[model samples]
Target: MQPFELVTVKDVPEAIRAQAASETAQQGATVRFIAGGTNLVDYMKLNVETPRQLVDINGLPLNLIEPLPNGGLRIGALARNSEVANNKLVQERYPVLSQALLAGASTQLRNMATTAGNLLQKTRCMYYRDIAYGCNKRQPGTGCSAIDGQNRMLAILGTSEKCIASNPSDQNVALVALEAEIHITGPKGERTVPISRFYLLPGNAPERETLLDPGDLVTAITLPPVPTGAKSLYLKLRDRASYEFALASAAIVVKRQGTRIDHVRIALGGVGAVPWRSLEAEAALHGKEATAANFRAAAEAALRKAHPQTQNGFKIELAKRCLTHALTQAVA
Candidate 1:
């Protein structure tokens, strides 16, 4: 690991001041604000992230789970994954979220991982994991080796010729299906970015992962209320159950009548640069009859635009099966 300084702050304001000052004081100094350090520490150990200073923000009171006026939930950034999953309100209202979180990592790691950190976790690409390989995400303009190389865990949507690394978060996939909003704090003040727009695609620059600026902190996440007869589920397919990463997964929220689909929201994981929302599939399902045939057709429509790699062509069919299964469960 690289040599760096550590600064401990008493509050969020002080931590913000320390980060802003560091950027102004040192030209090349890189600073990272740590809360739980579940993801950051792992990356640091892998030498994927080397910061000049580590600002501890665990002092901030950003870990509360408050209920909104609209019968929705507002989850703090510092709220641990396990805490949120076990929260009575969250478990009752957003069972899909709870199931997704529980499916991720282990009980101990989930206790240390925060909502913000989970959302900010980097991709799990093999080339990005190895320091020897040239990855554009690790170092911009260096080039992406996963493009023509072995890429079975890469993306099928929002990918570019430069990078095709998949975003690997089950929680985010559930959040996307639930249509949650992310609240952030920065120098310019506070702003809310919808979970849909919070993550950027690899249009030309895959290095820019999120819409966050320097020293910006995620404050909370809010979920909107849904109508009655709305069913939601998160289905993850992996090599094995417990600790393995997803090969392909689907999060589906469907509002249905007796035998017809009213509204449907679908987001795919392990197959996109971001939590990929399948608008085409959603459109195909809405106002259509809910049947196995329709679900299969929608799944195909969702993956029609997929660009698979040499080793990952199987993902196309795998993802389709997962989506169809998720849709069936949501209807059930």
Candidate 2:
């Protein structure tokens, strides 16, 4: 919305240099990288994000979806969501990831949204977007209006007094469950960070969302090999059937040996500040009989630490039911 300088670069090194040069020239000015401008453009129109310089990285060679030597997958950051969801390899190996992607926004938006951009999408909290209200994420130390305002869509777990906004990414929940790793390149070089540690809780500093450093660009996401014959499911519960954000969603991957559970991973969305991984539930279900009673117990263990707010109390029960249903579906 504001007048800003735009630079399009062909390669990763050139893009990094362009961003660094912009920062050096403008002193304290902000610089943002644009791939698929679906989310950034909306924030820019509202003046929520006011980056003085934009570096377009669409020309970079980061749009491939390739298979690793160890049977895993490497998804480029620029790969569109629709492409990843419809890719035969993704649909065959990681159906949960594909299901999560399809359960997200409409087909039109999915065709334009990139993998890295989707991971970096901001919270949809009304207070954070509206400039008239005070928000710790939008403006640190100013106070969070969502604390006492309309917080039905806010988080119930991993929430702090400063902020209760939820991480609204369906793909991220699946990634957290699958233990995906993020590949990032910056001025110093390149590094890989596990998906579990990528997102941060809204502790005192809600403004700091991810572990990405200044001038760092995400290159790809790597998913480790899924166990053969593993059963995984992603169940989303929203106010409607389609084109709606989840009120409570569950991503469960279960490996069963006859009647016993060999391994299990559970990740929850729409109920936490970050993609909520349930290690407690996994521990309870491990080496146990995959039964309805055991599933209920696992669901209870997962929601044990949930602290619900005034209007979002129903999320506790909703999340439990959703987890139980997802587990049943995974086993079935």
Candidate 3:
């Protein structure tokens, strides 16, 4: 890591002022906001991300987890992952989210990682992390080495000629399934963006990951109310049992009326460049009987557009099975 100036701010306005002043002094300077530093510090050690100025926003009043008037949940960006997962409201109302959070890193790391940091986490692509290799994400227009290199763990969906890195966040997959909204604060003011539209695909510019601007800071995320008696589950298929990224993961929320499905939401992880919401799969299962046959059909519909590479062709079938198992568990 390079030598940088660390400025701690007590409030949001002060943090914004520090970031704005730094940007004004040095045009095109990398000024990053640090909360838990679980991801940023690791990237800094590898020299993948070298910001000259670090604005610590841990002291800001953004750590509250509250219930909205509409029966929804409001999660502050600064709230730790463990804190959110262990909260009684989250564990009871949105068990899928809690399960996803628990499926992530170890307990120590989860206690240090923040909600916003988890959402903004980068890919685990080997080529992108190592500076020796050429990566479009790390260096634009340099070419992506993962295209023809070791890409067994890369994305199978939402891939372009430029890059094929997968999104590696379990919590993000659940958020996408729940149709959560991200609340962002910037120099201009505040705005809300849906999680589905927050992440961008690796079309031509793999460098730009999220819709967040230069000075934008995520404040909170809001999840709409889940239907009464709705059941949800998160299933992850990885190389190991603990402390591993998923090779194929599914988050399913389903509401059943006797044997028929009332409503369903599905999202996939570790298979796409962004957290993939499977609307096609949901359409196939809605109003249909919650049986093994319907689950198989929905799984097929979810992975119909998948385009696998040389070494990762097995992911297509694995993701389908994972989704099917999650749906079956949710309805059972």
Candidates 1 and 3 compared: the better one by lDDT is: 3
Better of 1 and 2 by TM-score: 2
Clash count for each candidate, listed in order shown: 0, 0, 0
C-alpha RMSD (angstroms) for model 1: 1.9
- Model 1 misplaced regions, further than 4 Å: 21-29
lDDT by residue (tens digit), candidate 3, 1-332: 89888989988877776776544312333789999999999988999888898999999999999999999999999999999999999999899999999999999999999999999999999998899999988888889999889989999889899999999999999999888999998888889999988999989988888887767889999999999989888999999999999999999889999999998999999999998999999999999998999999999999999988889999999999999999988887
Candidate 2 clashes between residue pairs 3 or more apart in a chain or in different chains: none
Candidate 3, overall lDDT?
0.91
Cα lDDT tens digits for candidate 1, 83-121: 999999887788889989998998999999999989998
Clashing pairs in 3: none
Residue-wise lDDT of candidate 2 within 1-332, one digit each (tens)? 78778889989988877666544321333888998898999999999988888999999999999999999999999999999999999999999999999999999999999999999989999999998999988888889898789999999999999999999999999998999999999888999999989998989989888987667889999999888889889999999998889899999989999999998999999999999999999999999999999999999999999988889999999999999999999999
lDDT for position 114 in model 1: 94
